[model samples]
Target: MCHIMHIFLNIKFFTLVDFCNAISYEHVKLLSILKLHNVKFFQFFTRFYQYHQGGGFVCVTTARVCSLLQYLFIVLFSTFLVECVDYPVLFNNKNTTADGIPITGKRHIQLMTLIFVLGIDDDNLGNLTWCEVLALLCQKLPDLHVIITKDKLNELDICQRILRFKNYFVALVNKDMLPPVVNIPFLGPQPYLSSGLKLNLDFLFFWGSFSPWEGPYTLKDEYKDPQNIGKLSNSFVCINTQCHKFFIYTINSCIPSVIHFFLLCGAYKKRSNTKLRHFNELDHQLQIRLSRSYDFATRYMNLFTSPLIEIIAKSLKFVTGSIFAVLFALAAWDEDVLTVNLEHALTLMTATFLIVIVCSSMITSDDCVYMPERLMRSIIACIHYAPISWEGKAHTRAVRKEFDSLYPLTFRYILEELFSPLITPFILFFWVRPRMQKFVEFFIRFTVSIEGLGDVCSFAQMDIAKHGDEKCIFILAIDGVAFDKDEDYIANDGKTEISLLNFAAMNPLWEPPPLAAEFINDLKTHVSCLSVFLILFEHILKNVW
Candidate 1:
């Protein structure tokens, strides 16, 4: 029936003809991609569901489970193959590198650059205004400054506002030959100058507005949530050394964001949209930088973070070589290798299954993020890409309903499987540990230290970041230093003279986990109960059943 349904859908799709009956080619492509991914997901989840449903005991013939798993790998590999074929078009090789344009120095980077907008239709508020952004940069960049490098600059209020800054310098670029994009082929965009900030900048940041291009739309910024990754590229930055780091990671994360942005924005005519243009670009750029810190958030910080980390960590197990090994070893013959592997299977399976669970949690997001890159990559393949969004409203509704329908059964099944191993630990940790800790302050206090400190720092940073320093300090005054450290802690050495770290550590906010020695009493009770139940069940199933 499932096979027949699949065939029927395929036939109907190809047969459709007429205006209303027709779907957008993009939408059609999305369905095709979704269909493939959905199949992979279904096969994986079905086996996973069944594995946990039957009391979490595999007890199935090893050969049978092994076969399903092999088939599962093939389906998943096909998805990867589809992606490998599709990701190149939307993104070019290498991330944006801070390469040569001859404006870098060691302690001082003196750049005289222009943000030439390629074009903006006169009707749109955001078509090409750099007023708020220029004002904000001139104000915030400490000792650094910018000058009006072009005569055209004097013509706009945004540029005039910038000229008023304490350290502003001015120059006028020739309007006729303005480089519209940040990077041009023959001669790069106007170079920027950062005297003392060259060494410390996350990356010497700047952009070229699409003022001159007169192309399709305004090009504001081409990045989102970019991160400084690996080694610095060419970032030498001595007056003559002239090093510049390309920041590949940042550029990669931005591609999808930029493409999506262009798609949403590109479709509109300049005259149709009128919106206030304010201090948006700079704030957005800073936000992107901050989110890169998500790479460091611990599991305790966010439950979701652990799952993503686990997915990235386990990517090796699903490698082509690994898949080949499984295929190569499939004879199931009675050789020393088979026996040895079988003996080790239990341990490996436990680890593999746990990893798989973590990866599965990110499947939805992973699917969303890569779908466009994949589809865009396959531009010539004619395979339509899925809508690249975390929230596809219509799709979300369907997923929610589907998830809800499966939730009760899945949750119950998972709970049953999970409860077996966890029940003893839960009782020990929650019930037993508390009783022992009731008498021991030192042990109890030590167990949750990071969380305590994390709560303080995270909450404080979040507040300070949202409101200004004054607002943060004002709010801080009321929270009142609970401990002496609060008074002395330094937030960041680079940001300000004030220290928040002293306050961070001295607060005695976080406590470390307890050693097992302390929890033995509670553990004994749970372990005993669990052991007895297992033994009894074992005999009942083995002998009675």
Candidate 2:
């Protein structure tokens, strides 16, 4: 019996030592993790105390507390770094100015011209004659004046003159006298073609004016009058000329104004996708750390049997203690009274049973009433990326569905139950109000940019296309019929076929509906205006009544 008792004592002592060692190790591990993440011990302690006061640590073991602290330290540290750091903006090196402004296609052309002119060698300039110099200057500048007091131009060295010109150019740029950068309109062929082909095609379209339909044609006797032919040809030419002029005017006058309006409205706010992505990534990391902490805390606490059993044991003790106190009171009362009423005794017992059951139900166990960590995480994520209007409610639902689909049905149900109460109020306060303000701001800007030219040009283009196609077909038919020599005029038939094909290729400008490029540009402007206006109108109505 003594030998058995000594062995039992040794085992108990060893078990106690192991438990103490484990607690010490966990404390050290937690401190190390906090330090690794650059979290100060003082801040950690402050937060831990606050968390404890918040009832987060109620009924939780010391090891669980350590795990919770470590998780919080990582999340808080990451959030601090993200909020404090101002990461440098990165710009593409290619086609970008020294100050990191992107050089648009139009600005690029002007820069290239300036470079080419300045790159001329001194020897090459010296060999060029006066006429060549004047021609080169004409190409460089639209307005040129050469005032010379000297009788002979031979006194001026072309190289020195060019160098002087370059110095003047530098001085102007230094003084900020240069024109503001502009994106040149892509007025040539569509960009689908290869660069070399596009360049050649653009050159031909720019310099060549030979129309396939403007070839030699013998009119019928009734239509043979030279004056009548001249009048007929002049009308067609006038119509085409007017159409080209209108197109040019719209692009040159209207597009720039619209662009300027949008700019002024601050519609072109510079937002970095990379920064948003970084924020999202930080949020994800925080979520993972929280999950890990919960797992660690739960595992450590569960090392001792089930928490539910412990809760039940605690509840039974409370009920038994209450019963004993009641019995003692009743015995004392019975000593004071001759006898207790049977009905009163029965009522007292029944009331005590009901009270015990209710109190036990209210005594939530640590396992049963844990923090809604997953639900909290989902809410935080939604708050971060939620759309700011009822217009985007469908989108929010779609996003929720996608995310929810990743989880099992049991988890999904819990998340939905928690999320439902928060969704409406959170979206209204956090998302909608600020977005409405932005909508009003951008709406004013869009209205200013359009300057009442909204869709007028688009409508005109459509009308032109509708009428132009009919006119083209009529003109082609007249040419084919007038030039027909006989029923067997195979040669004339071939020419007419070729002409029709060529016309078809060139007729894209006057095709129904508009070019895809023009349509997209117009659509963007229309949608911007319409969306902003509708949102503002909705906001006003909502506030008024």
Quick one: best lDDT, which candidate? 2
* Residue runs of model 1 more than 4 Å from their true location after superposition: 1-284, 297-324, 328-545
Q: List pairs with backbone clashes in candidate 2.
A: none
lDDT of 1 by residue, 405-521 (tens): 212222333333232232322322333233322212211111111211110111122122221233323322323322223422222211110112211222223221232112222
lDDT of each: 0.27, 0.31
Taking the tens digit of each residue's C-alpha lDDT, what string does model 2 give over 300-413?
A: 222233457657756775876587467657757784322343435544556666666655544544554433333323332322222223122322444333333222233233
Residue-level error in angstroms, candidate 2, position 464: 49
Q: Which candidate number would show the highest TM-score if scored against the true structure?
A: 1
Per-model tally of clashing residue pairs: 59, 0
Q: What's each prediction's TM-score?
A: 0.16, 0.13
| lDDT of model 1 at position 60 | 28
